[model samples]
Target: MTPAARHAAAIGILDRWLAGEAAEKALTNWARTNRYAGSGDRAAIRDIVFQSIRCRRSFAHLSGAETGRGLILGALRAAQTDPATVFTGDRFAPAPLTDAEFATETALPPAPSGNVALDCPDWLRPLLDRALGDQALAVLEALRHRAPVFLRVNSLRATVDQAVAALQAEGIDTRPAPLSPRALEVTGNARRVQTSAAFAAGLVELQDAASQAVVDLLPLTAGARVLDLCAGGGGKSLAMAARMSLQIFAHDIDAGRLSDLPARAGRAGAPLHLLDDAEGPERMAPFDLVLADAPCSGSGSWRRAPEAKWRLTAERLTQLCAIQDSILTRAAALVAPGGVLAYATCSLLEDENSDRIAAFLDRHPDWRCDLSRQFTPLDGADGFFAAILRRVD
Candidate 1:
């Protein structure tokens, strides 16, 4: 497709989104009906649509209107691309810009402030401010970009040097991430990662550097009984297994969320015992380590899903806090005396991170916080928090 045609396609998708249709659904429907678009064309169009959405307010202002045409023009201008060359009025290209459109290009809309400036909802500004302080804007700006692909070197299977060599053999380049000893940030051709021989041979698994650091902080030993209470997809569970020959028991309140664990475990050569809610008290036991990787607003992942920042509501955040609290309480009960309980979240909000841990410690006076740490997107990884607590008899 011509560059002009790509812009036209993006405008079409943006129009559907503006009409209240979901971004993914609109993009998918467009792709399905346009079989003439190749994989590269589809990916390019998708990037244009997502980039526009990520900076909707700013793009709307620059483009002079919030319509599809305006957004594409604004996005192109923001990227410093010459629209006249692309919108050349050629076959399959967008129409030439009118005198009115050209005249109005210089008269941009007012710059949004506070939440709107960040492309986030108004209700969330205060919370984000409280959580991030003077660095809030930097954090929000970081979200406007894409996240890097990180892989955790399965030390049990291969060393970092060995994994990097194997991955490089497949034309994949990587650099060591400073955040975690076991992490390697994919530098080039990251999209081919799933098909790389290194991945196929179980030498590496896709994981955030912050997530790997969180697991590395835990002191796991052979023969230890561990319970991953909120083990969604069992990423950490599998990582922990690779760290030691531990008797790992993974569980989630919603068992269906863990449906991929068996297959993922098989590929990683890690053994994990999956427990369903129906397993009941029969599986209840004092575990040496109990981990609750609770659900949250997913603030850490905004770089990958910019739409979530606009979709978050005050009420939804409050509900998430309550759920996190409950999970901490329930998961703590399964920790053996003298054992440790680890609580974690991907949220950058203090209320969802340290605050929840503080509340739990208040309720359980006998448990002491062993260690706690938080990371932000600017720190070279997704924002995350993890607190380790030891139960004292």
Candidate 2:
């Protein structure tokens, strides 16, 4: 498809998103109906849509409206591209810009502060402030951009050197990430990675460096019984399995979320036992290590899923924190005497990360924090935080 047609396609999809449709679902539905769009076309359109979402507030201010066409025009303008070239009104192209649309002032819009200004939900600004303080603005600024793809070399299957050689042989250039020993940040050929020999051979798995670091923070011991209490898709579970020869047990409140984990574990040569919700506390409690990679507002992943930034609300955030607190309470019960419980989240909000940990510590005097660390996207990876706590009794 021509570049003009791509912009037009992105405009249509963005319209769906603006009209309350999810970004991924809308894009997938569009792809299914428009089989004429190639993989490159789909990816390009998705990128444009996400870019618009990431800078929605700024773009809306510049373009003078919140519609899809206005967003596309604003995004193009932000990139210093000539909208006239792309919105040529030719067949399959976006309509020509009206006089009012073209009459936008050259000066940038006045700064918005807190949530409206940051393009984040109002309720989340306070949490971000509490989490990062003066760095909150910088972090929010960094989130209004693209995320780099990082791969973790599953050493259980292939050594880092072996995986690097394999990926490099497939025309993908990657550099070792300082955050995690197993992580490699894809510097090039990310488009071809899915079909790369290294990926197909299970020598590498696409995981953020920070996420790898979170799993790395877990103090794993050989032959220990570990449970990933909220192991969605079991990414960390499999990573932990690769780190140590532990009897790994994976469980989630929604069992369907883990349906792909068995196949994924098989591919990565990870041995993981799946526990259903029906399993009683008596049977599953007393684990040496319990990892609660709990759900949250997903503030850390805003760069990748920009649409979620606009969808978050204060009430929703409160609900998520309550759920996280509940999960931690339940997960603590499963920790054996002298066992460690590792809590992790991809949220940058203090309420979800440090604040939740504070609450947990307050409620459970028997457990004490061992270590806590957080990684921000500005550090060239997705934001993540992990806190390891040990039971005294």
The superposed Cα distance between candidate 1 and the true structure at residue 253, in angstroms, equals 3.1
lDDT tens readout by residue for model 2, 1-393: 999999999899989999999999999999999999999999999899999999898777668789899888878777778888998999999998887876663454654455655676656677788888778888998898899999999988999999999999989999999999999999998988888878877788889999999998889999999999988888898899889799999998889999988888988899999999677444877899899999988889999878778888888888999999998998888888888989999988777898999999899887899899989987789999899998765
Q: Rate residue 176 of model 1 by lDDT.
A: 97
Candidate 2 vs. truth: CA RMSD? 1.8
Residue pairs in collision within model 1: none
What clash count goes with each model? 0, 1
TM-score of each: 0.92, 0.96
Off by over 4 Å in 1: 18-22, 88-91, 95-100, 110-117, 280-282
C-alpha RMSD between model 1 and the true structure = 2.3
Q: At residue 259, what lDDT does model 1 achieve?
A: 95
